[model samples]
Target: MKLALGPLLYYWEKQTVETFYQQALTSEADIIYLGETVCSKRRELKTRDWINLAKQLADAKKEVVLSSMALLEAPSEIKILRQICENGLFKVEANDLGAVQILAENKVPFVCGPAINCYNASVIKLLINKGMQRWVMPVELSRDWLIKILAECTQLGIREQFEVELFAHGHIPLAYSARCFTARSENKAKDDCKLCCIKYPVGRPATTQEDQQVFVLNGIQTQSGYCYNLLNDVPSMQGLVDIIRVSPSGTESFTSLQDYRAAVNGTGSPIQLASKECNGFWHKIAGFQTQQ
Candidate 1:
C-alpha cells in the first residue's frame, strides 16, 4: 500500500510549515499532499509557495498532489480554486463540487477528496466518468462498507481504475462549517478574526464531562477528539487501500508518519503509541469510543 502525507490542516508560521515539509521528505510516506485543505485565510503559504513546495518534494522522488479547500465560501476562494485546477502539474484533490466542476470541464485527472460524500458505487461511477483518478473514502465509512462499495463497482461493470485512499491516521476531520469554531472560542467573529488559529497550533482540544478529549477546533474544521490511529488495521488495509493518508496536524504529529511507516512495514505498533486510542470508527461505532 502507498503512504501519503495529507496537507496541513492547521495554521502555522511560514517557516514552521516549510520546516515540516522538509522533515516529511525523510519520512516513510511515498506521496506528499501539498496546499491548504482548510481556510484560505491562513496565509502562511501562498499558491506559488505550495507549488514550489510540491516541486521540491517531487524532486525528492515523492509523488505530490495539490489539495483544495474543503469549505469554500467566497468568490476569491473559487477564483484561486480555478487557478489551482489550471496549474498543470501533478494531480489535484477536489474537496468540493466547485473543484470537481472545474476539473471535470477541463477533463483533468483528479482525486475525489474525502469531503465529496461518495457513499455508493454510483457516485464513484459518476466521478469516474468525470476523470477521477483517485477516491478517498469519507472518514465515517467503515471497512465493511468500503468493501461493499468496491463489490458494487465490480457488479456494475465500472472498472475501479481509480486508486482508493483512506484516512488511515490523524485527527478525524468530522465536519466543516461556515462558523469558525476556533475564532469563536477566542471570542472573535469569523469575518474579523485575525489568525487566531495559530495560537492553538494543534487545535484547542474539547473534552467531555469526564475530561476525555472529544474534538479539536481548527478554524472551521472540527476533528475527532482522539487521533484515528489505524496501525492494527494496516494488515487488512494492505490490498484495499492504494494510499493511506497521514495528516500533518502540527510538528509533533509528523511522528505519525514514522509510526505509520513502521505499521506499514510491520515493524512498529501504532495503536500502542497513539496519543489517544480509537478504533470505533473502523468498527462502525461511536468515533471517540476505543476498542481493543
Candidate 2:
C-alpha cells in the first residue's frame, strides 16, 4: 500500500512548516497532504504558500492533496477553501460539506477527509456521484466496519471506482469546535487569544484526575491523547487498503514514516515512539486501548 502524510493538525511557525515539508519530500511518504486542517487563525502559511508547496511536492513525483479546514467559522475561511478548490492543480480533500459542495459544483474530483463522517456504502455512493475520488475512513471505524462497507460497495458494483485510505498512524482528531480550546485553556477568548496554540506544537495534553492522558488540546481541535498506530496491522490491510496515512507529530515523525514504509515493504519491524499507542478504534474497543 502507498503511504500518505496527513496534513499538520497542530499550529506551527512558517519555518517549521516549511522545514517539515522539505524533509518530508525525501521521506518514505508516497503521498503528502498540505494546508491547514485545524483553525484558520493559524495563518503561518497563507493559501498561496500552500499551493506553492503542493506544486513543489507534486513536482517531486509525489501525489499531493490540499486539505481543507474541518471547522470553518468565517467567510474568509470559506474564501480560502474556494481558492484551494479552484487551484486547478492538485486535488483537494474535502473535510466539511462546504468543501464537498464547492468541489462538486466545480466539477472537480476530491478525496473525502476523515472528518466527513462517511459511515456506510450509501454515503460513499452519494459522494461518488458527487465526484469523490477517494474516501479516507473515519478514525473511529473498525476493520469489520470497513469490510462491511466494502462488501456493500461490491454488491452495488462501485467498489473498484474509488480507493480507500485509512488514518493508520498519529493522534486521532476527535472533534473540532468553534471555541478554541487551547486559547480557552489560557483563559483567553478565541479572537484576542494571541495565537496561544503555537506554544504547544505537539498540542497540550488533557489528563484525567488520575494523571492519565484523556485528550490532546490543539487550537480548535480535540485529539486523542494516545497516538493511533497500525504498523503491525499493515500486513492485514494488504488488499483492503490502498493508502495508509501517517499524521505528523513530534520531532520523530520522519522516523515514524520510515518505520511505516519499512513495515509495508517487509524489510523491518515497526518502531515504537510514544509511550502510549492505540489501535482500539480499529479493533472496536475504547479508543485509547491497544489491541493485539
> Which residue segments of model 1 deviate by more than 4 Å?
252-254, 269-275
Per-residue error for 86 in candidate 1, Å, reads: 0.6
Which candidate number maximizes lDDT? 2
TM-score of candidate 2 relative to the true fold: 0.97
- Per-candidate TM vs. native? 0.95, 0.97
Local distance difference test, per candidate? 0.87, 0.91
Residue 204 lDDT (model 2): 96
- Candidate 1 to native Cα RMSD, angstroms: 1.5
260: Cα error in model 2, Å: 1.2
Candidate 2 structure quality by residue, lDDT tens digits, 29-113: 8999999999888889999999899888888888999999998888999999999999999899999999999999999999999
lDDT of candidate 1?
Answer: 0.87
After superposition, candidate 2 runs with Cα above 4 Å error: 270-274
Best by the TM-score measure: 2
**Pairs with backbone N, CA or C atoms under 3 Å apart (clashes), candidate 2:** none
